[model samples]
Every structure is written in C-alpha cells, then in structure tokens.
Target: MSLNANDRSIAAFTMAGHALVHWFETSIPIFLVVWLAEFDVGVALFGVVVALGYAPFGLGALPGGILADRYGTRPLVLACLGGMSLAFLVLAAASSIYAIAAGLILWGIAASVYHPAGLALISTGVEDRGTVFAWHGIAGNAGIALGPFVAATLLIFLEWSVVAAVLAVPGVLAVLYGLGAEFDPTAAVADDADAGPDEALSPAALFSDSRTLFASAFAVVFVLVTFEGLYYRGTLTYLPEILHGLPAIESLALPAGLEGIQPADYIYVGLLVVGMAGQYAGGKLTNRIAPARGLAAIFAVLAVLALAFVPVTASGVGLAPIVALCGLLGFFLFAIQPFYQNAVAVFTPPDARGLSYGYTYLAEFGFGSASIALGGFVLGEFSQTVFFAMIAAFAGIGGLFAGALLVGGDRFAGTAETLEANADD
Candidate 1:
C-alpha cells in the first residue's frame, strides 16, 4: 500500500530525529578516549565518562515512555532533539574532566528520553512497524558504526570541541522541522485507532498493570537485550582504549597519539555495515525464521566475534586485510538487530509501545554502563588480553541469556496469544 504524503513526511521526520540522536550519541565512546588523552587521565576512567553518558537511558526510560503515552509522542521527540542540541552546546563549552562528565550525564539523560517516545511514535507513525523499525535500526546503527570514523577524522583536523559543535547541526534541524508541523498521532497508531478500536489502555495504565502478552514478551527479550547491551558496550566502548597498548600496534611505526587506529575499527564498521545490510534482509525474513531465532542467532554470532576480537587485538598483522576480516565479523554480529527490533514491535501495543521500548533500551544501557565501568576497571587492574577475554566471557554469558529466550520465546508467544484472546473475550 502506498502511503500518503503526510505519513511519508512523518516517517522522514522520525528518521531525521533518530539519525541526529545517533550522530551525537555515537561520538560518546570515541570522545571518551580522546578527551581522556587530552585531559591527561588514566584510561581506566573511561567507564566513569562513558557511563555518565550512557547510564541515564535506564533511569529515564520509564518516565519517558509514560510521557509519550500521556501527552503525545511528537512533542516529546522534538523536545528530545532540542535537548540533545543543547547538550552538544554544553559539551562544546566544557573544560575540566568534571565539567565534561557533567555534560555527558545531562546529555545522556536527555537522549535517553528519546527512545521510548520516539520509538513508540515510530511504531505508530509508519504503516509497517517491522520495516519501519528495520530502517530505524539501520539508521541508528549506521550512525553508531560510522561515528568513530567521524570522530577520528575530526580528531585529525579539528579540535574535539569543534567536532562536537559540528555534529550538533542535525539535531537542531530535526527540532525545527518537527516544530513546523503537526499531525494526528492517534491516526498513525493504527488505521482504525481513531475509531476507538482495541487500544483502550493509556500508556500509563498499560505500564501500571504490565500483564499484557507484549509486556511478558518484553521481559524475555529484556534479559537477552541486557546481555547484548553489555557485550555491545564492551565491543566499541573499549575499542580505541583497548587497542591503545598493544605491543604489535606500537611497532607499526605510526606517529605518536594516533595508535588507536587498529585494523579493528574497519572491521567493526564493516560488521555494522553488514549488520545494517542484515537488518534489511532480516526484515524480509521476520515472518519466516521468527524474531526469536533471528535474535538468538545474532547473539551467538556476536559471541564468536567477541572471541575474534581477542586475536585481532593481539595479532599484529598488516593493517588492511585483518581489518577486513574484522569488518566481516561485525557484519554477522550486526545482522540480527532488525529481528530484535521487530520482536519488540510485534510484542508491544499502540499505547505502551513507548514503555516497552523504553524499558528494553533501559535494560541495554543500564547494564551496558555497568559493564563498561567494570570492564574499564578490569583493564586497569589486569592485562589487555585478560580484559578482552573477560568481555568475551560476558559475551558468552549474554549469548546464553539470549539463547534461553529461544527456549522460552514460544511460551511468551503463547501467553501473548492467550492475552489477546482474553482481551477479545
């Protein structure tokens, strides 16, 4: 079915907002190392800064979701963009490590506000939530995947402050475009939502009760996503810092301070690019393999890739080819995101979609923050090999959690079916 111009515009608007959020958010890890180096701090403190920037997604998820349900998703999303733009401004002006950490915390809190509201809005805004989410996943992941390059490139030329200032452009534009327009979000929820169909419970009410099949489904996915979140955080958050001390990399005869440019970044980006490609392909398969199996497989691949990272970090092979292999690993790791997103959408409802997604993201970031903090501390205390090995172990643990979802996913599916039947009754 062809979407009318308005829905198309709305979808575009949502994507723009999502992209802007990702643009700034992706820079957090890279900035952690760059700023740390510039500030003359121990690399172990990478956790303190990164967590300050990332942990609030957990803290704000529920409230953000509730705001979307009670008020409206549109205004909330625009507000988030405005907040994000303002955050970049603060980050640009920050001086001391304390100041930057504060800025990151504020930015994290504000950015966290977007996911529940924005994701809920997207679930309603577009016609096919699965495809819409796949695109959303691609857009966000691609930004994350590409952000390091952006940071690295900027680091090569401009000051870090200027780099942040430059990245602020998209967020400001998103807010402006959103403010200039208006639409019936209720209409977007479902074609028949305006007719007072099945969507009775408010986002808050649904959140308060939390018994829907969708909510239960979210619980199972929540555990797995948490595992993925930890693994996710360990993967890129520690990348540049992890590679900082490798003996082989030191021998590359590269100039001082630019040694973080391992073949790994290319591999990581390649993996993400592949994953983005996978999201596109996986969306097509959501009806066949199921989001459960797809997510499980995705987690398994990420675990393997984590192990692969150990060697890539340790082995001092020539830069180009090893990096290419790294990218291939990333491709497989990233491919499963669409399935995870679709699973969230299918299991959720129009009203509380915000809360479902909000909580899911919260699970991801909260654990991710803690994991990075602990991982950073571990790196400070032990060998880089041990550090990478621990992250790999966590990946294995996360995979086990994700795999259990494969075992239990059907139960939630059955429960959701029963709830729908009861809701119908």
Candidate 2:
C-alpha cells in the first residue's frame, strides 16, 4: 500500500528519530574502548557508570509516555532531540569519569522519550502501520550500524571528544527540521470511538488503564521484551570490544598509517548492517505470521547464536567462518525487534498507545539495563565463554516466554479487532 502524505511525514519524522536514538546508542560502545584505555577503572565499575545513565533511560519511559499522552508526540520528540544534542555537548567537554557519567545520564534521560513518542506516533498517525514500521526498523538499523562506523572512522583522524562534538550537530539540524514538519498526530485514531479524550488521564484513571494493560497479553509481551533487552544490551554493549580481542579479528591487516583502524569495528558494523535486512524481513513477516510465533523462532535462534558466538570466534578455522557467524548473529539479533514491537500494538488499545510503548521500553531498556552491570561482572570474573553462556540464557528465557504466548494463542489478551485492523491488506 502506498503511504499518503501524512503517513510519509510521520514515517520520515520517526525514521529520523529512530536513527538518531540508535546512533547515540551504538556509538557509546565505541567510546567505551577509549574510556577503558584512558580511565583507571575496572570493567565492572565502568559498567555501573554506564548503567547509571541507561537506568534512567529506561526508567523514565513510563513518565515519558505519560507526557506524550498529555501533550503530543511532536513536542516530546522535539524535547528529546534538543536534550540529546545538549547532552552530547556535555560529553564532549567532560574531563572526568564522573563528568562522563553525568553526560551519559543526561543523554539517557533525553533519549528515553524517543521510542514511546515515535512509535506511538506511527501507531496512531500512519495508515500503513506495518510498512512504516519496516522502514522505521530499517532506519534504526542504519543508525545502529552507522553510529559505530562513523565514530570509529572519525576517531582515526580526530580525538574522541572532538568526534563526540561533531556527532551532536545532526541532532541540532534534525530539531530545526522537525519544527517545520507538518502532520495530524492522531489521524489514525481520529475515527476510533475508543481513542478517548485528548487529555491527561487522572492518576486513578492511569492506574486503571495500566492495570487493564497488564491484565492482558501486553503482560506477556512485557516479559518477552525484557529478555530481549537483556540479550541486546548484554551482547551489543561489549561486542566490538569482544571482537577486538579475537585472534581472527586481530590477525587482519590494515595499511601502515591506518593501523588505528580496527578491523573488528568494521566487522561489528557489518553485523549491524546485515541487521537492516533482518529488520525489514521481520517487519514484513509480522503481516504473514503471528508475531508471537515469529518471536518464538527468532528468540530460539538468538539462544543458539549466543551459545555459538564464543566457540565460533575462538575456533582457529579462519575469519570467514567467524564473520559468517557474526553475520547470522546480527541478523537474528535485530530481526526479533519488529515482531515484539508489532505485538505491543496488537495487544493494547489505541488510546493508551504511548503508555503501552512506554511500559514496553521500560521493560526492554529499564530492567534490561541491568544486564550491562551483569555482563560486565561476568566478563570480568569469568571467561568470554561464560559471558556468552549468560547471554544464551537470556535468549533462551525469552524464547520460553514467546512460546508461552504462542501456546496461549487467542486465549491471550488483545481484541481480535485490533489484529484485523493492523493486518496488512
């Protein structure tokens, strides 16, 4: 189906918003390498520092959602972009670990508002929900891949702080662009009788609505998203660093003056690049298969990938086999996202879309942020094999939850009409 002008506008805004969010998100791991080398800190301690920022990123989602509900997506989105840019400026000027922590926390708080606002906008504003989401996921994956790629590429020629400063410029431009963008924010929900008044929910009403959501299939989705978050944060948070240590990656040669270019970084970028295909396929697949079923299979694949990651990297076979493994890992790692994202929309009412997404991310990022600490501790105290084992456990647990959703079938909550409404023609 062709997108109308409003749908295109919303998709464009969201695609930009989604890309910027991941751009900052994936770039952090690249910075982590510099911080580790420069700062006199252990991995475990530094993980806590990172967690301090990420915790609020997730924890604030609930309130961010409430704000999105009270105000509108555009205002909150503008706030998110402006705040994230300013936070990066602070990071660029930081002189101490404490300063970096403060900057990360600021960025986390600022960036926290994006997913809820952007996804809710798509859910309510875009007529071609699934197709837009596919594009949205593709944009996010582009950011995910490009953020680290750009950061690594720039670090070769510039200081990390200067690179950070340069990265902030795009958000400033995006904010300028957003101010002039036009669209009806709630056009999809305009005709729905159940969209409720465009006003703030009372505390009591909020509680009731939240209770209703938790009472439904959204509850299962919450669990599934949380595990997905754990696997995501656990793996991606340290993946580039992990790849850097491999003999397979270390053996690759670069030009003499370009010794600063770590092949591992590009390999990591390639992995995320493949994830763009995964995201597109996952989004479109939701139109054909039950999202829960797709999630079940994807999570199962993730579990196997996590278990295989260390062995494959450690094997002396060659870089080809290792690269292939990372490629597969990247594809499945991201492919699961659209499935769960679509699931959230199907399970919740349109009126509470923002809050629903807020809670969804709270589970995904908030509770999931703890894995940073957990992963750091595991990597520090145990071997990389053990660390991957822990990741496998997270994916395995997520698969089990996905299975529960599949087995429960229509007995799970969510109105049938929502499924029909969201189904692609």
Candidate 3:
C-alpha cells in the first residue's frame, strides 16, 4: 500500500488500541469498591495504584515523542500495543494488589507510547491539516465516549478478571496490523533537517526546556488539560461505585438492562454522551466565538456542576435531576477540548511540535496521576460528592485561566466582537 493508505490504517489501529486501553482502564473506576473488597486494599494504596497507572504516562510522553522521531511510528506503535496487551493479559491472572498495580503501570506506559507518534504520523501524513486533525480529535473523544460504556456494559455479566482479559484482544489485533505497516517520517525529518537550512533544532525543545511564550501557553493549557483529565477520569472511575451506592441506577445502567436503575450510573452515561455532544458544539462555536468566551462559559458551567456534584450524590437530591445535570455538565465539559487543542496548536512551532504535544500530556497525565490519588483519598475518606466538588474548583480555575489567555490581553481577546463583525459580511 501507499504511504497514505498505510498511514491511515496504522492510525486506525493506533487509535483503536489507545481507545481500548482507555475503555479497559475505566473498569478500575467502575469496580473501585469491588476491587477494594476483593483485594482488601486501602484507599491510599488504591490511589497510589491508580496514580501509578498514569504516572509513567506523564513522564514518558516526551521521550516517547523523541523516540518516535528517532525510530519509526510503525514499529513503536505496534510494540507499545503488544506490550499493553501483555499487561492486560496479566490483569486476568493478577491475584494480589501489587500484581494489579504492576499491570496497570505497564499498561499506562504502553498506552502513552501511541499519542505523540500517532499524532505526528497523522499530522505529517495527511495533506489537509484541518480535516485530519479534526478527525483525530473526534476519534480520541469518541474513544473516551465509547470506552466507558463498553466497560460498564460488560460489567453487567462478567467478572472483573474476564473484563480485563477481554480488553486485551483489541490491542493484540492492533499490534498485528501495526507490525505490518511501514512509516518513516522521523527518518525523513532527520534527513531533511541535516540537508536543509541550519535551523536550531535543539533537544531542549523536545525535552523539559521550553521557550517563554511556549512555557506560558503550556502552563495555561496545563490547567485546562489537568482538569479535563480529572473530570474524565473521575467520571469513568467513580460512576460504577456511585451506581452501587444508589440503587436507582442498577435497573438502567447496563446495556442488557440495569438490574435496577442506579441514578448515578445514568448520570455517568449521561455525562459521557453529553460530553460527546458538547465537543461537537464547541467545535461549531470555536470560530464563531473567541475561545476565551467559550472557555469562560465552560468554566462557569464546570464550577456550577462541580458544586452540583455534592448535592447530587444521592446524599441530598434524587438521581434523576443529577442524571439530567450530568448530561448538561458533559455538554460543556467535553466541549472545551477543541478550544484547548486550538489554543496550543496556534502557539506551537513545527520543529518542537513533539515536545509541545508531550508536555501538553505531561500536564495532563501528571495531574491525572495526582487527581486519581486525590480522588481515591477523598472517596475513601470523605464522600464521593465532596471529592467531586473539589475537582469542580480545580476545573473552574483551569477554565478561568484559559479564558484569560484567550481574551484578557491584546493576545487572545476581541475575537468574539471581530467574529460578529465578520458575520455582517
């Protein structure tokens, strides 16, 4: 096959593998309490376990980017997937807490391998940057949207071990296909950079060293992405636990039909679906309104929803309204992604694009690791409601910062007004 066809197929496999891990890991959050009971693990340890899964992802992303640039996306992608499938297969037989944590950590390492390279591949491979990137974004979010549902549905009939084992199959398939493809863009980059103009392609650009503007923009986005991961992780991880707490959703939570309706499960599913819708909405509004205005609006919504989380915990209100609110919350929550992506895309340079992508995720998964720890601590010590409420504050602050970046200065502001003017033409 031609490079284009090969790239697309590889992209599909890469994305699918990435999404499967995303979906598979949701099981941890879904079966949080169950795992506790089955293994007798403590909350702190639980948090550590969860955090460890993502800890490597934050640390490994940049290097992975460099490696993908040095090696080939085709080989790296397949090896990573194969490694992850091996990790999941380990999950099926894990008899102790340490074993499970080990599996998750390895799996996380494996999962992190795909993004930087996969993105670089797609960005360089496809001729139209916009169409390819938009599709890539949609694929990622769609994975986030679908994985939890697939996980939760399987939970209805399978043991956690079975579920863990089953999730490995897709990765195996991804590896098989990935190994057969040939993509050598990084080699091309190496060759061209050597022969072309003496542009400064420093290692610092890819590693921890970032320019001032890039650093500032990265910090702003760190907050945004941290909250995004926190929200996504919390929703996927806690919904099942929340469902067990509320008898209302047991009937409705499953695909086969919830044995009962756990209003919380409905809320979880609602948030995901709404999040998917919100991404679409955000995409539509990004060019029409300044990202700052949209971000401000999103933050405002996140803050309200975060606070709302406490009341909706079935400790105070019924599940139905919370379920509705979950959908509403998701609508605004997931919509912020494009705005975030666009903001970063606008600020980053071509040479250091890998570093930019890596650090963006470093902020994402680093805080993600921390957030899981925090969520586990809170859920173990306090109410899930309170845990969620605190995240609201985090999400709110992140959104506010993003908004400020968009419009507070001469840099990102007045687009809303300008767009309005453009509409008149």
- What tens digits encode model 1's per-residue C-alpha lDDT throughout 145-193? 6666787788889989998888787788778888887655555655433
Q: Write the per-residue lDDT of candidate 3 for residues 123-237, one digit (tens) a residue.
A: 4444333333444455566666566666677878998888878878877887777666664443323433321111343465323335443435555665677777776566556
Candidate 2 versus truth, CA RMSD in Å, comes to 4.3
TM-score of each: 0.78, 0.88, 0.72
Which residue pairs show collisions in model 1? 267-326, 267-327, 271-330, 271-331, 275-335
Measured by TM-score, the strongest candidate is 2
Worst 10 residues of 2 by lDDT: 416-425
What lDDT does each candidate get? Answer: 0.68, 0.85, 0.62
Ranking by TM-score: 2, 1, 3
Summarize candidate 2's per-residue lDDT along 178-205 as a digit string, tens digits. Answer: 9999998888889865453347457766
Residue 325 of candidate 1: its Cα lDDT? 56
Candidate 2's TM-score reads: 0.88
Task: Kindly provide the TM-score of model 3 when superposed on the true structure, using C-alpha atoms.
Answer: 0.72
